[model samples]
Target: MFKRLILFILLASCFLGHAQTYQVEKGNSKYNAFAFIEAQKIYLKLVEDGYATTEILSKLGDTYYFNDDLKQAQKWYAKLFAHYENQVTPEYFFRYAQSLKAVNKYEESDVYMVKFNTSKGFDARSKMLEEDSNYLQMIDFQSGRFEIANAKEINSSKADFGPAFYASNNQVVYATARESGSVLRERHTWNNQPFLQLYTADADENGVLGNPKPMSNLINTKYHESTPVFTNDGRTMYFTRNNYDNGVYLQDKTGTNKLKIFRSYKNKGKWSKPEQLPFNSDEYSVAHPTLSPDGKKLYFSSDMPGSIGYDLENEFTRSDIWVVDILADGAFGAPRNLKDINTPGRETFPFISKTNTLYFSSSGHQGLGGLDVFTSSISPSGSMGKVVNIGKPINTTYDDFGFIINDDTQTGYFSSNRPGGAGDDDIYTFLQLEDLREECEVHVVGNVTDHKTGDPIKDATLVLFDMNNNKIDQQITGDNATYTFRLDCDQSYILRVVKEDYTSNEEVITTPTSSGLMRTSLEIEINRIPVADCDDIGPLLDIQHIYFDFDKFNIRTDAGYALLKIKAFMELYPQVSIEIRSHTDSRAPDQYNELLSEKRAQSTRDWLISKGIDASRLTAKGFGERRLLNTCANGVACSSDEHQLNRRSEFIVSGFGEFKDCD
Candidate 1:
């Protein structure tokens, strides 16, 4: 659902009674009606005729920009900025930057992006650029699963777009500007081509589609029609068409015939005459229809009232994708904007997949170039997730949109004007590599238990924290003593459990570098603290058996007891400073084991702090899985107990006392 800008329409209208040549007036008329391709031809002619004013150059650049011709847009934008640098708007700066990126002029683009941010300090687009200045890094990695090919048999030399699956059968329904056998041979002045019509064709197992034929005369008219979407049950169909009645095109007082969403029901063996949606109006346009997987909601694009971008009277009113409830009686509800995905820029061609993923194309959000396809997860309750670009080959710096996918088959189609396409806008099929499309979720599932009794500790508080010690989530264990938390990926986490009458215990859980969703299971045991006596804090407080798992730094329940004695000694002598040395068995990589050992040392110091010892009184360091006490070094045969002895923690007094190293 691409919305071509008619930015110069308002400027052209202001010259109503003023003297202007016929070519300029004709071009302005087409431009005002969003006929950018035709307007481009007219503007280029005027440029050849020696009428290349600053406004003419800007308009020419916009025509190419809206048409997804980034190279041509960049050429004109460069000339316009060079001559009218002090007079141009910030929007041109942003478009110029995007054009530079499309042509791979990244370093040069950044210079203009900085200028755009400075010009519009508080704009969302500006803020987005500032926050993720290195966003190109995210696009470099491609999902190597897709093998894309043009559906050449189904394509036409004219504009072909908005591909959708037909009901139950292997057939697909799409929109095209090709001539039909019907009597409505009318041409759309917008592009000097036949008005778009809904066409159906069969798609083979290999995704090559057959030549398409137009739908019944009842649905086709002498007006624009496109974006046909069907329900899963194949009972109803929703599509986009211009507002026309009988032989007359319905227009508002402003001479604008707006687009509208229409519904057609299938009865017996035939499709009923389409009916205009109740929420549609002549004052604004509503087009590009898509339905949710359940068919309980309808999503479409509109430039009606309540849009955030520049109003229509000023220039181009950027359209927004909106959804409406399909009531139980098959009636429509009032429309609501999808604010989570919509920006002040144009967002169109929304395709809701079987997995409840809302796919759409946008010009407002930061992207590689013109409308880039993006996906956002929709929860069961209809909550929208963060939007992420589909990236690289699937999305070029051109207008790549109208996405449709089948999660089960992992195959889908989308329309694009990207390089190497069959024509102006061609349909391409893609297959997802099942293994590569893994979920980016982390689940920490664990049970808390009492140390001595080894019984489940119900209702224990569990807190999840990041490496920075910031609390992410907190929950109490269920009656079964199990707790679960869903965490983000590419991050480190710590799980701490606390029970009444027991000391708090913490464990580190690191996510693996491997792809796909992961779950980490832990058995946390919190011990009951015992009252310490001064005699327990002897001069040689040899805390032994402070153990760690292979390549793990988190303190265990048994090891917490050995550290508790050191906590008692610290409380006994407030002036004493202690240094903690942690080690790991030589079973893992040196770099990994060293990091594990350091975390273990820090965990020991944190435990002492939790036990009322000041952090200033203690320091910690790791010995990188090195310095074995016995013969448990690398390549040495040893029992499990011998290896465990090597992964031990040691405490050394550094202040207010004479200390001797222990063997």
Candidate 2:
């Protein structure tokens, strides 16, 4: 919902044929007006009355997804996929993946991810995923170079983002949806949040922000105002606001007010009223402004159509970064889309650093997930270099954008919703630790090689698993057979190695809390598991362990991959019949653990059957808490790692004559 300047939607009454079409039409009108809550109620009522048309089903999913009701979104999205599998679009596939990830269904999400990539192969969304199949592993194992903390003094329990450093001053300006002290209470229907307004705060020498207050009333209005930018001389400022002039507001035929860039002058210590920019219009939005270092050009984002490389039939409409020449006479030239940096997906929140580097956020680029911040060098001729994602601890599977840097103090701030935060969107500060060498931080450097011949292995997938057996990060070895990862301190890790037709390997390594940032070298020696090993098939196949999330029976992505290996082994020795045994840790009561283990056993069998194994070739059973691999009994206190060793599933060869056991 952040920086969503494009609120244009059209009603599709032409597709309605049921008796409840009138109610659905009313819902569409509410949806166009951004009244998502009212629109959701009407859509739900229609569904309850047996109106499950394709349009209504799609609208229901959209409402919940945009409202951040990820669980509900997943439910409706699943139903929609089951009913209209042939007509689903790439956008729906992307949204379905997002919702699945939110609910920790990473394996199922990957299933949709493959379909989306196949359909939209040329989009950045597909290219990014293809480039880094193990991005999650890389993000989880990172021990960040700079220490990050929430800007507590300058934040409120509302949506706050888009932080910009004031020109040559310690004060920082940002946008927030928090209510001002006044009585204006117009909430955006897309989200029930209040309209955004500009706020400023001062940062002290310690880089702590405090004493935030609203900006001049002349700049803040009843409509939204955000993304403030100031000139180098600090005499003029530029910002984004709704298309409201004097006492009347200009809106498109859809009754949606478009955003426009405005300028304000500061004279004799007071800010003047804002004047609408000449290039603004009521048809499209032109917002999120940033100026070049020399003040010769102004950059912003807009969806005015005719965008470079945009296709109208693609269904994925997004804004492109546009720039205009700011002439010396204080006039603006025609806007040109930044083809080098912008993609078919949304790219906004432009910031030009002191070193002539352009920093912005994009959903179209290859990233961990969601909106990721990227950097590109701006040449003296205003051309852009290759854009690269500024990877995690800073970026995550959630939205991370509105990045800014301060070269004067070598300190900067950005906004994110990754895990722990003060609000929905919190501003975090980063101080470049110059004294601490970047390469000296805690890390793991390793090479994957064949155990038999000592030859370097390329394209080998290496994953880092935490002490509790959760997959943290992953990387595929390059031609040099090398992989490096910044690791968290004082944590134990299991390096998992998997390659085609080779036995998977797991190596345990622990990092000391006092270890300075330096490379911890490791050599992963993986050997080939011959087909003969599958004959006995009782833990000798070197099959990797099947893991699930805490208190869950569903398979994870890593576990799903591991199961495929087991299925292949079964095919290699078709005469061998196997019994599937599942177990649970001693955390819950005996009855509950027994039921959970049974469900897990059945789930494992179901997966194998789906992989083309005969159902009669396997027998499912659960051991519950009766099987303790460690000393963690009922009353014993143990670490999560110790307990995880007990929650496992194993396949035991029951007989060599599978014809007798055949159904």
Candidate 3:
């Protein structure tokens, strides 16, 4: 009976799996909620039983998504459209095409790319599709032979990371498990036992940081209180806390509690009043609280119910990030799962930039082993990018955490406890780069010096950009903000300099690579400017074209128009990666998007890979939100324009990566 019922759900849900079957049949929710293993099994059974339909295939894709099974998801989604040949719905065609690309099936996936060119959501999807990879996919392993910070004899020590900057105050706040121990305390995997704490220090806009000191106990909990952030005024502080109340310690011990967030205030020459965050819970847990630069919103991690199709009450859930806006009355609004940015694997430690870019940590997504940093961007109209991994130097076989940026200056901070650290985690500083972005050959070199002092700007932000106008590399100048970058001939470059209170200066250097690599760097002079200079122009995108292959539901050749635009964007930004979103037009089964979009996004990503793009830089997804685009979803009375727009494949910049086009 159970197998039969499971079979039914598989047919009903489609894209099924063996490992996830019984749970779907039982209907018991998960703690982290990637997918009910049972549900996954039932879905898989249907596929094995020859009951697979476009709809069933889509559900199976969805199951893979929740499990962070990008490859499997990509496979099912591809099978649907890869061989598709017929007048199919726009959503399936576009989405299936993209899914094939995401898994590096580029040459094969482009076929379905044509349908998306004229799809309804082309406008929104274009912006994302036309993006490229940057340094933000900083997995330490990818550094090739570059010595890791933890391996270098330099400043590796303590549980250091999570650098938050207060531009107005010229200070930084971060978290470290360096507190309360001779060496760092052992990290408890299951419960994340409370050992981390908050700390602060002085930082120059140039990226130079002074020795950090522990935050007063008023804000740092006896247990763990890491990931500190502050308001623009620097008065109010928001932080993530692991407490006795939040039952993280109860692993199999079976205690009923939850993880939480806390806030504090500095008053009368002293810090006081540490209070529990009101929205936290015992069912699901919340940690790593980060506030928007404006202090009007709060973002954090939780295993809470309704977050990415999971229930936080269970013990086995993987952690995903969630966000809540700060209401006018200073109250926190209900938490909402950052859907597009998160998946079945774990998404945690979210950080946001003034540019609507995001940074976070994840274990489920592809990476070295321990956690790695990932990024995404929120589009002009409020959509998000598919989460992409930060590769090389910044991330590694160990864990990386607390990624924060000083927007205008292109400087950033994060922490790690890789083998070479002094003890646990130690804070490390880096700068975002733009000019001299090519891997080798001729390079551009320059210095950011004090306009009046003539001294090199130590730690001043030096950003290097590519044609797409986004930052590709970042590092603090050992002496001054003086920096150098290697570039290919014929590629365009942009470099910017910024320090707190100092007016930001950007220089553009376009050397014809075809003319051979050349060396050039003009000094950047900065004067103190108000943060208002961070003004943002709305992003624009055009849906180029979409295509499909013979008999495949996934994309194939001929999708180049749309894919190249994405490639062009990546070439331009150097610091950006895209989240290719796939969808199925309403003509197919409702469950198709889960598979179709997953396949399409992945296919689009894979195509880019074939084009020499990095896999870590792209994230693929299937929204099945065909519900919103399908005028037939609610049987709404709408125009063909609206309906068509909804049945398209799209892309979004989901995170702050090496490709920020800094001005």
Between prediction 2 and prediction 3, which has the larger TM-score? 2
Number of backbone collisions per candidate = 1, 9, 168
Residue pairs in candidate 2 whose N, alpha carbon or C atoms collide under 3 angstroms: 34-189, 137-472, 137-473, 137-474, 138-473, 138-474, 440-517, 441-517, 442-517
Query: Residue 183 of candidate 3: its Cα lDDT?
Result: 47
- Relative to the true structure, candidate 3 has a C-alpha RMSD (angstroms) of 26.0
For model 3, what is the alpha-carbon lDDT of residue 270? 68
* Candidate 2, position 359, lDDT: 86
Model 2 stretches with alpha carbons more than 4 Å out: 1-20, 45-53, 67-72, 103-110, 120-122, 136-143, 308-311, 314-316, 418-422, 434-663
Q: Compute each candidate's TM-score over C-alphas.
A: 0.62, 0.62, 0.42
Better of 1 and 3 by TM-score: 1
* lDDT tens per residue, model 1, 1-663: 123345466556656424336777787877877688888898898888777777778888888877677889999999888988777777778789888877878757766876776776556665555444445644554335566778888787777889998866388898888764555477766556678888898888866788688888788887888999998877688899888856668886678788888888898978998888899898888899888888899988988887665454346678888889999999888898888888777889999988788999987776777788888898887878877677766777788899888787888898998767666888888876642333565544556777667687778898989989999888776544656565656778888887765678888888765433354434445432332222222235655647888766778998887777888767766767777888888787889888888998999889989888988877788887678888777788889888888887777666554333333
